[model samples]
Target: MKEIVIGENQAGQRFDKYLSKYLNEAPKSFLYKMLRKKNITLNGKKATGSEKLKEQDIVRLFLSEETIDKFSQVKVERSHGKLSILYEDKHIAAVNKPSGMLSQKASGSDVSLVEYLTGYLLESGQMKEEDFRCFHPGICNRLDRNTSGIVIAGKTLAGLQEMNEAFKLRSLKKEYLALVEGVVSSGAYLKGYLHKDEKCNKVVVEKEPFEGSVPIETEYRPLAGNQRVTLLNIHLVTGRSHQIRSHLASIGHPVIGDGKYGSKKSNQLFCDSYGVKSQLLHAYRLTMPELKGELNYLSHKVLTAPIPSDMKRVLEGEHIEESIHE
Candidate 1:
C-alpha cells in the first residue's frame, strides 16, 4: 500500500489530474477502474476521482510497490550548466538564458533550462530530490533556441499557476532588441494577419486575413541606425511563432542573421563580420503588471537583460552607440 499526501503543489487540482501526473504510465481507464474498485481511496474512503485535492489531504493506494513503480515515470538528471540569474525570490526566478539553450527538453535525454533550474535549486538546498514527486520548478516562458534573453521560472506550484495565468492574460509586457538590415527611421505600431506553415516551420505575415490565419500585433522603435543597418527596440504585443522576424521582414527590415526570414547576402555579411550565425534578436525586457499575492513583489517592476556581446559589437561597429539608451 502506498499513501500519497497532497502538498502545496499537488493541491488545488482535480484528483484524476493529479493521478495522471503521479502515475503517468497508467491509462485513464485503468485509474478509473481502480477508483471504482476502491483500490484508490481519498481520506480512507473510496473516491470518484472528481474530488478537488487540498493541502494535507491523504490519498491511499492499495497497490504493490512493483505496480506503482511500473506506472510512475520519475527521471531526474541534474544539469551541469551554470545559470545567469537576473532575479530570484521564494516563489519565482528570472534568468538570462543564452543563445543555443533549450527552454524545455525536446527528447527524453535532452538537458534544458528547466534541468539547470532544478540543479541550481538542489545545490542551493532550496529543494530536495523527494520534493519532485509532486512538483518541480520550471520555466514559465520560452525563447527561441537561437534567440537569447530573459526567461522566467516558477519555483513553487502556486507560483507556476499564477505566472502562467499572468502570461495568458497578456498582463506582463514583453520587449526585445533586434539588429536588422536597412535603417528604421521612426517607430510604428504594425498590425497584420499571420499564417504558419508547420511543415516548413515558418510564418507569413499579410495585410489581409487568410484562411486559418490569426491576427498579430507588433510595435517597434528605432534606437539607432545608418543606411545599411538599424538597431530597434521591439514591443511584442501579441506573441506568436516567429512573429517579430516575419513581421519585420514584411516591412523590409528583416533581422540580421535570421536565416529563416532574412536576406542571405546580409546574413553572410554579418556572419563574416560578427560571427553571428543565428538571429540577432534578444528578449531584452519584461515589465510586470499589477500582480497580487506571492508575486506582488514583482508588481510594476521592470526587468532587463544586457545586450549580448556579439550584438553589442555590431552596434559599436556601426557607430550607433551614441543614439542608444543604456
Candidate 2:
C-alpha cells in the first residue's frame, strides 16, 4: 500500500489529473477501474476521479509494490547549461536566454531553458526529484530559438497559474529590440492580419483580414539609427509567431540577419562584416502587472536584459549607439 499526501503543487487539480501524474505509466482506463473498485481511495472513501484535491488530502493506493513502482518510474534529466538570471523571487524567476537556446526542448533529446531551470532548482536545493512527479516548474513565456532575452519561469503552482493568466489577458508588457535594414526615422503602430504557413515555417502579414488569419498589433520606434540601418525598440502589443519580423518586412524594413523575412543583401553584408548569423532580435524588457496574491510583490516591476555581444558589436560597427537603458 502507498499513501500520497497532497502538497501545494499537487492540490487544486482534479483527482484523475493528479493520478495520471502520479501513476504516469498506468492507463487512464486502468486508473478509472481502480477508482471504481476502491483499489484507489481518496481519504479512505471510493472516489469518482473528479474530486478536487486539497492540501493534506490523503490518497491510498492499494496495489502491489511492483505495480506502483512500474507506474511511477518517470524521471527528469537535468541539463547543466547555466542560466543568465535577470530577476528571481520565491515564486518566479526571469532568465536571460542567450541566442540559439530554445525556451523549451523541440525533441526528446534536446535540452533547452526548461531543462536548465530544472537543474538550477535541484542544484540550489529549492526543489527535489520527488517534486517533479506532481508539478514541473517551467517558463511561462516562450522565446524563439534565435531570440534572446527575458523568459519568465514559475517556481510554484500558484506562480504558474497567475503568470499564465496575466499573459493570456495581455496584462503583462513585453518589449523587444531589433536592428533592421534601412533607416526608420519615425515610429509607427502597425495593425495587420497574420497567416502562418505550417509547411514552410513562415508567415505573411496582410493589411486586410483573410481566412485563417489572426489580427496582430506591433508598435515600433526608432531608438537610434544611421543612414544604412536603424535600431528600433519594438513593443509587442499582441504576441504572435514571427509577427514583428513579417510585419516589418511587409513595411520594407525586415530585421537585419532575419533570413526568412529579411533582405538577403542586408543579411549577407552584416554576416560578412560583423560575423552576424541569426536575426538581431532581442526580447529586451518585461513589465509585470498589478497582482493580488503571492506575486503581488512583483507588481508594476520592470525587468530588462542588456544587449548581447553580437548585436552590440553590430551596432558599434555601424556607428549606431545603443541608448536603451537597462
Candidate 3:
C-alpha cells in the first residue's frame, strides 16, 4: 500500500482519474470494484471515482509493486545528442525541435522528441522511472516531421493536463514564418474546407464543405517579398495536416520547395539553385495567454525558435532582413 497527499496541482481532479493515473495497469472496472470493496480508499474511507480531490487529501493505492511498474515504466533508448531548449520550468519545458525529427514516432525503431524529452528528464535526475510509475512527462503539442519550431513538453501531470486544455481551446497561439512563391502585396484572411486523402498523404482544399471536409481558417501578413517570392508570417486559426501548404497552393502561392503542393518547375529551380528540398516553412514563434493556478508561470509569455539556415539564405537573397515582428 502507498499513500499520496494531493498537492495544489492534483487538487480538484476526480478521484477515479487520479487512481487511473497511479494504477494504470488496472482496468476501470477493477478500480471501481476495489473502491466498492474498500481496497482503494480516500482519506481512509471508501469512495467513488467522482469524488473531487482537495489539497491535503490522502489517497491510498493498494496495488502490488510489480503491477505498478508494468503500467508506468516504458523503457526508451535515450538519445545522445543535445536539444535546443527554449524555455523550461519545474512543471513544463519548451524546446526547439529540428525540421527532420519526428515529434512522436513514425515506426518502432524511430527515436522521437517525446522519447528524447523523457530521457532528458531521467538523465537530469529531475524524474526517475519510479516517479513516472504514476505519471510521465511528455510533449503536449506536435509539429509535422518536416516543420520545425517550439514544442512544449509537460514535466508533470498538471502541466500536461493544462497544456492539453489550452491547445484544445486554441488559447495557445502559434505563429510561423514561411517563404511562398510569388509576391503577396497585402495580407489576407483565408477560410476554406479541407479533405485529406490518407493513402496519398495529401489534402484537397475546397471553397465549400464536403463529406469529409473540415472547416479551416488561416491568416497571413506579408513581411517581405520580391516578384518571385514572398516571406510571410502565418497564423493558423485551425490546424490540420497540410493545411498551410494546400491552402496556399489552392490560392496559387504554394510554399517554395514544397513538391507536394507546389509547382514542379519552381521546385526544380530551387533544387538546382539552393539544394532546398523541404518546404520553406517553419513554426518559429508562439504566444500564450494569462494562465491561473498551477500553470500561471507560463502566462503571457512568448517563445521563439531561430530561423533555420536554409530559410535564412532565401530571405537574404531576396534582400530581406532576418525577420519582422509586430
Q: lDDT winner among the candidates?
A: 2
lDDT of 2: 0.92
TM-score for predicted model 1 compared with the true structure: 0.88
Estimate the TM-score for candidate 3: 0.85
RMSD of 3: 3.1
Q: What is the TM-score of each candidate against the true structure?
A: 0.88, 0.93, 0.85
* Local accuracy of candidate 1 as per-residue lDDT tens digits, 179-238: 989978899999999999998888999999999899999999998788899889999999
Off by over 4 Å in 2: 28-39, 44-48
Q: How do the residues 1-326 of candidate 3 rate in per-residue lDDT, one tens digit apiece?
A: 87788765567779988777766667899889989988788999999789999989988877676766665444445666678898888888999988889999778889999888878888888876656544667888888787888899988778888888888888878899989999899999999999999999999999999999999999999988888999999998888889999999999999998979999999888878877888888988889877885888889789988998888877777677655578
RMSD (CA, Å), candidate 1 to true, equals 2.7
Highest TM-score model number: 2
- Pairs that collide in candidate 2 are none
Better of 2 and 3 by TM-score: 2
Distance from true location, Cα of 72 in model 3, Å: 7.0
Model 2 lDDT per residue over 127-224, tens place? 98988887999889998899989999999998898999899899988999999988799999999999999999899899999999999999999999
